[model samples]
Target: MDAQAWDERYAASELVWSREPNRLVAAELADLPPGTAVDLGAGEGRNAIWLASHGWSATAVDFSQVALDKGARLAEGLDVTWVCADATTWQPPAPVDLVVVAYLQLPAADRRRAVRNAVTMLRPGGTFLLVAHDSTNLTEGTGGPQDPAVLMTAADVVDDLSGLDVEVVRAERVDRAVTTAEAHRGEDRRTARDCLVRVVRR
Candidate 1:
């Protein structure tokens, strides 16, 4: 969806995503000392707010101004700057200690562009982490984008930044449990497959 479409979606709802950070994002980054960070495609600044609460100077970038506005309201006194821009092309004023790309699903070419550009925004030793629905999620997992073109895998993410001076800390498929109505009734279980890529600029 484009910015306007996202704006409608965000404006129509109180909150599109949760108030807390993504589980994998928190688990992978909590160990690192707080620093300047960017949460690219931050839907509602949840992760960015979480980072600020933990002492990181965070920036939340998204194309939808409506989403950013809501995020700003949610982040009233936090150290987070909300910017309305295309994640595929947005550039930070300076290299930061961390760049996080979460669920920014796009076509292959655009996804590659965004991932490559995100890596460039990282200073030496800076971390670049991406979490998204795995390509296999459409066929083998629970809920996610049904379009395969937008879904990606760990290998695809690593390949997107191939030849860059970076060290791959972790790249693998991870499972996220999604509570379903059946589960609430103690009937069935479901999981969403997601690809997680964590790298450090060398």
Candidate 2:
């Protein structure tokens, strides 16, 4: 979906995504010392807010003004720089200690470009975490983008970041339990199957 489509989706709902950080994000970064971080396509700042609370100076970038506005309001007292820009082209002011790109779907080529862009923003030894709906999730798990172009495998992400001495700390199809509220809302009957990849910049 484009900026306008995402804007409409956010406008139609109180919160399009959960208020908490992605489970994979929390788990992977739990051991790392806090530092500068960038959250690409950060919708409503859930992960960005969580990063701030965890001592990371975060920059949250999203194209939708509505999402950025809501994120700024939600992050009223936190230290997060909210930037409204398209993730495909936005560049960080400098390399950061952590770079997060969670569930930001696009065509295969565009996805690779975005991933490369994000990787370029990571400082040496910094962490780059990518989480997305597994390609098999469309037929096996809960609801997510049905477009095959957007869904990907862990190997796909690894391939995209090829030249970067990336060691896949975690690359697999993991089952994440859904909340009761989500289930009751008919969001998805079963847990989500997500592909997670954590790599360290060389």
Candidate 3:
């Protein structure tokens, strides 16, 4: 979806995503010391706000101004900068200690562009983290984009940054549990497959 479409979606809902950070983002980054960070394609600034609350200066970049506005209202006094810009082409004023791209599904070419551009915002020794619906999620997992073109694999993401000077920390398919109506009634919860990539600029 384009920025206008996303704006409508965000405007139609009170919160498109949760107020808390993504599970994997918090789990992997909680140990790192606070620093300047950027959340690319940040939907509602949840992760960026969380980072700011934890003492990190965070910039939340997204194409949808409506989403950014909602996030800004939610973030009231936090140190989170909301930028209405395309994540695939936007550049930070300076390199930061960490860059996060979560659930930013796009076609292959655009995805590659976003992945590569995100890395460029990281300083040497800085972290770059991305999480999205795995390509296999359409058939093997649950609750994600049904379009295959937008889904990606961990290896695909790593390949997107092939010429960059970075060390892969973790690049793998991971599971995210999703609660279903059946699960609420005591059935097994389904899981969604996600590609998680974490690398550090060398």
The models' CA-based lDDT, in order, is 0.94, 0.88, 0.96
Instruction: Name the lDDT value of residue 187 in candidate 3.
Output: 58
Tens-place lDDT per residue, model 1, 89-176, is 9999999999999999999999999999999999999999999999989988998799999999999999999989999999999999
lDDT (Cα, tens digit) per residue for candidate 3, span 119-196: 999999999999999999999999989999999999999999999999999999999998767634775689999999
User: What stretches of model 3 exceed 4 Å from their correct place?
Assistant: 182-188
lDDT of 2 by residue, 5-88 (tens): 889988998898888898889987888899999999998989999999999899999999889888888888888999999897
In model 1, residue pairs whose N, Cα or C atoms come closer than 3 Å (at least 3 residues apart or on different chains), thus clashing, are: none
Q: Which wins on TM-score, candidate 1 or candidate 2? A: 1
Q: Assess candidate 3 and give its lDDT.
A: 0.96
lDDT agreement of model 1 with the native: 0.94
The candidates, ranked best first by lDDT, are 3, 1, 2
The CA lDDT at 137 in model 1 is: 92
User: RMSD in angstroms, candidate 1?
Assistant: 1.4
